[model samples]
Target chain A: MRQLIDLFVSFFKIGLFTFGGGYAMLPMLQREIVEKHKWATEDDVLDYYAIGQCTPGIIAVNTATFVGVKLAGALGGAVSTVAVVSPSLIIITIISTILRNFAEYAVVQHAFAGIRVAVAALVVVSVAKLFKKGVKDVLGYVIFAVSLLLVFFLDVSPIWVVLAAIAIGVGKALKAGKGGEQA
Target chain B: MIYLCLCWEFFKTGLFSIGGGLATLPFLSEMGSKFGWFTQEELANMLAVSESTPGPIGINMATYVGNTVGGVLGGVLATFALVLPSYLVILLVAKVMERFQNNRFVQSSMTTLRPASVGMVGAAILGVLQSVLVNMDAVRAMAWSQMLSWPNLVLFAILLALYAKFNKLHPVVILAIGAVVGIVCKL
Candidate 1:
C-alpha cells in the first residue's frame, strides 16, 4: 500500500513537471526514478523508452506503466498510469472550461490567432527534426514520402499506414533471415 | 452516444499513435472534422493549450477535447480510455520482459514505424498551416491578397527565427510571447 502511494506521488510529480510532450519527461524520469529512487538503472530506463516508443499509447504513459509494473506489479502500473495523467486532467479541465466561456472575447480570439502561429512554427521544427532523426536511408525516405502522400492526399487513416509499415518491415526482416540462412 | 464515440476514437488513438504525443495530431484533426466537435481553429487552440500545460500532449489533448464534449466525466473517461491500451499492453510486456526487447520482430517493426510516424506528423503540418496561415474562405472567394494572414505569417517567421537563434528556449515562454504579441498587434 505504501509503495503504491509512493508510485502515485512520484509519477504525479513527473506528470506535473513534464511540459511540451512525452520526451520532455525524460530528464524528470532520470532524476527521480533513477537518481533519487534507485528503482531502475539508467539502461533500464532506456530500454523502457525503446519499448514505449514502439508500443501503443502515449510514450510517457507507457513509460510510467512500465516502471510502475517493475516497481510493484500490475496494480502499481495502473496506479502510476493514473497518477501521471492526473495533473493533465485536472489542469486542462480547468483551462478548457474557462477558455470555452471566454472564447468569444476579442482579446481571447486575438491571442489565440497569435498562439496558433507559434504552435505552427513549433510543429514545423518538430516535423523537421522527426524527419532528420527517422529517415536514415533510401528505404526510410521512400516509406516517408509514400506515407505522406497517402495521408495528405488520399486521406488514408494513419492506423492503416502503421499496420502496412509493420507488414513491410516484417517481410523485409524475414527475407533477410532467409538470406542469412543460405549464406 | 457521444461518450461512446469519444471512447472509441481516443482508444484507437492510444492504440495506434506510435512515437509520442504529437503523433496523435493527425487523428485528432480527423476526429474534429468527422464529429463536428471542434473546428480547425479550436484544434489549434487546443494544441497551444496542450503545449503550455503540464503532462503529455496526447493526454492533455484528450482531456481538453473530452471536457469540451461532455464536461468533467467526459474528460476523465477520455483520459482513462486513452491510457487503457497502454496499461494492458505494458502488463503483458512486463510478464515477458526479458525477451521482448531483443525480439527481432519488434525491432524491424519499430524501424519502419518510425519513418511512417514522421510522415503522419509531416502531413499534420499542412493542416496547421492551412488553418493558421491561410484563410480558406478568402481563397474560396478568390481574394488573392486577403487569402494570406500576413500577421500570422509574420509572427510565424519571427518565432521561427527566434527558435533558430535560441535553440534552447522553453516553449511556454515562446507561447507567452506569442499571446502578448497577438493582443498587442491584434493578430
Candidate 2:
C-alpha cells in the first residue's frame, strides 16, 4: 500500500516533470531512485541503465519495472508501471482536450522555441555520455561514426544498420569457417 | 486494424532505433511529413513534454503521436505497438536464457550492433538538427555572416558548458536557463 503509493507518486512526479526524453530522465531517476527513495544504489541504477539500453522496452519504464520488481514483485512491477505512466495519461488528456487553442498563444510558442534548443542540448550532452561509456574500442568508434553518417547524411533507417551489422558479424564468421578457423 | 498499423509503425521503430528513442527522431520526423498526423512544431513540443514526463521516450512519443491521431484509444494502441517487439524478444530470450548465453554468434552480434546503434543515434541527431536549426531559405542561402554570429555562438557555448558541467541537473533547470539565455540574447 505505502509502497504502491510511493511508486505512483514518484512516477507521477517523473511523468510530470521530465523533459527532452530518456537521457534527460536519468538525473531524475538518479534523484528519485538513488537519492530520495534509495530504491537502487548509484551503481545499481547505472547497471540498470546499461541493461535498459540493451533491452527492447523504453528505458525509464524498464528501469521502473526492474526496480519495482527488485523491491517487491510482479505486483510492484505493475504498480510502478502504472505510477510512471499515470502522469502522462493525465497530462496528455488535458493537452488533447485543449490543444486547439494551446498552439496559438505567442507566449506559449516562445517558451516552446526555447524548450527546443534546451531539449537538443540535453540530448547532445547525453549522447556524449553514452558514447564515452559504451564506445570501448577502435571498432566501436568506427561503427559509431558510420551509424552517424548513415542516419544523418543518408537518412537511412537504423533498423537496417543493425541488420547489416548482424550480417557482417555472422558473415565474417562463416567465411572464417570455410578457411578452417575460429575466433 | 488501426492497432495493427500502430503495431507496425512501432515495430519498425523498435526493430531499428537501436540506440534508443533519440535514434527514432529522424523516422518520426519523416512520419510527421507522411501522415500529416503531427506537425513539425507539434512533434517538437511533444518531444519537449515527453522528455519531462515519466515513462519511456519512445512510449511517450508514441502516446503523443497516437493521441494526436486517435485520442485515448490511439495512445493505448501506440504504446502497445511500441512495446510489442521488445516484449516478444525479451520473453523469448528469457525462455532460452541458458542454451546460448555464451554463443559466439550472439556475442559478435551484440558487438556489431553496438556500433550500428551509435550510427543510428548519430543519424537521428543529424536529422533532428537539420529539422530544427535549418529552417527554409536561410539554410539554403548559406549566409556565412550570420552562421557564426557571436550571440548564437555564446548561447550554444553556455548551453553546452552548463550541460557538461552539470550533467546531473534536472532538464527543467536547463530549460529555465535557456529561456533566460534567450531573453538575454534578444535584448
Candidate 3:
C-alpha cells in the first residue's frame, strides 16, 4: 500500500514537471525513477525507453507503465499510468475551459497566432531531429519515403503505414535469420 | 453513448500512435473532422496550447477533447482508454523482459518502425503547417499572392532562429516570448 502511494506521488511529480512533451521529461524521469527511487537502473530505463519507442501509445506513458509493473504489478502499472497523466487531465481541463471562453477575443486570437507559429517552428525542429536519427540507411530511407507518400498524398491512416512497416521489417528479419544486423 | 464513443476513438489512437505524444496528432486531426469535435484551426490552437503546458501532449489533448465532448468524467475515461493499450502491451513486454530486448524480430521491426514513424510525423506536421501558416481559404480562392500568412511566417522564422541560437532555452519560455511578441507586434 505504501509502495503504491510512493509510486503515485513520484510519478505525479514527474508528470507535473514534464513540459514540452515526453522527451523533455527524460531528465526528470532519470532523477525520480533512477537516481532517487532506485526502482530501476540506467540500463533498465534506457531499455524501457527503447521498448516504449516501438510500442503503441505515448513513450512516457509506456515507460511509466514499465517501471510501475517492475515495482509492483499490474495494479502498479495502472496507478502509475494514471498518475503520470493526471496533471495533464487536470491542467488541460482548466486551460481548455478558460480558452474556450477567451478564444473569441482579438487579443487572444493574435496571441494564439504567435503561439501557433512558435509551435510550428518547434515541430520543424523535431522533424529535423527525427529525420537525422531515423533515416540512416537505404532501407530506412525507402521506408520513410513510402510512409510519407502514403500518409501525405493518399491520406491513408498512419496505422496502416505502421502495419506495413512491421510486415516489411519481419520479412527482412526472417530472410536474414541469425546472420547479424540487417541494416 | 458518447463516453463509449470517446473510449473507442482514443483507444484506437493509443493502440496505433507509436513513437510518442506528437504521433497522436494525425489520429486526433482525423478524429476532429470525423466526429465534428473540433476544426483544423482549433486543433492548431490546441496543439500550441498543449505544447506550452506541462505533462504529455497526447494525454493533454485527449483530456481536452473528452471534456469538450462529454465532461470531466469523459476526460478521465478518454485518458484511460488511451492508456489501456500501453498498459497491456508494457505488461506483456515486462513479462518477457529477458528475451524481448535481444530478440531479432523486435529489433528489425523497431528499425523500420522508427523511420516510418518519423515519416508519419512529417506528414502530420504538414497538415498543421497548412492550418497554421498557410492561408488555405486564400489558396482556394486562387489568390496566389495571399496564400502565405506573412506575419505568422515572420514569427515562425524568428522563433526558429532563436531556437537554433539558444538550443537550450525551455519551450515555455519560448512560448511566453511568442505571446509577448504577438501583443507587441499585434500579430
Highest TM-score among the candidates is held by which one? 1
* Per-model TM against the reference: 0.97, 0.75, 0.94
Error of 2 at B29 (Å): 3.1
Give stretches of model 2 more than 4 Å off.
Answer: A1-52, A60-87, A95-100, A172-183, B1-4, B39-41, B141-153, B181-187
Candidates sorted on TM-score, descending: 1, 3, 2
lDDT string for model 2 (B1-187, tens) is: 7666666776677555555666566567656765677776677667777767555567677778878777788876766566555545544443344444445666566676767765666565554444455544554688755443354345556777888898678876876766666555541
lDDT of 1 by residue, A31-91 (tens): 9899988999999998898889888989999999999999998888999999999999999
List residue ranges in candidate 3 displaced over 4 A: A178-183
Error of 1 at A20 (Å): 1.2
Best of the two (1, 3) by TM-score: 1
lDDT of 2 at A13: 75
Reference-based lDDT, each prediction: 0.89, 0.66, 0.86
Docking class of 3: medium
> Please, what are the lDDT tens digits per residue for candidate 3 over residues B12-90?
9999888878888878877887789888767777777788788888888888878878888988898999999999999
lDDT winner among the candidates?
A: 1
Residue by residue across A1-183, what tens digits does model 2's lDDT show?
898789778876775555545665778888988999998899877766655566665666656666666667666666766666666666665665576567687665666666666666776786776677657888778888887787666656656677788887677566666777544
Models, CA RMSD each: 1.2, 4.9, 2.2
Per-residue lDDT of B115 in model 2: 70
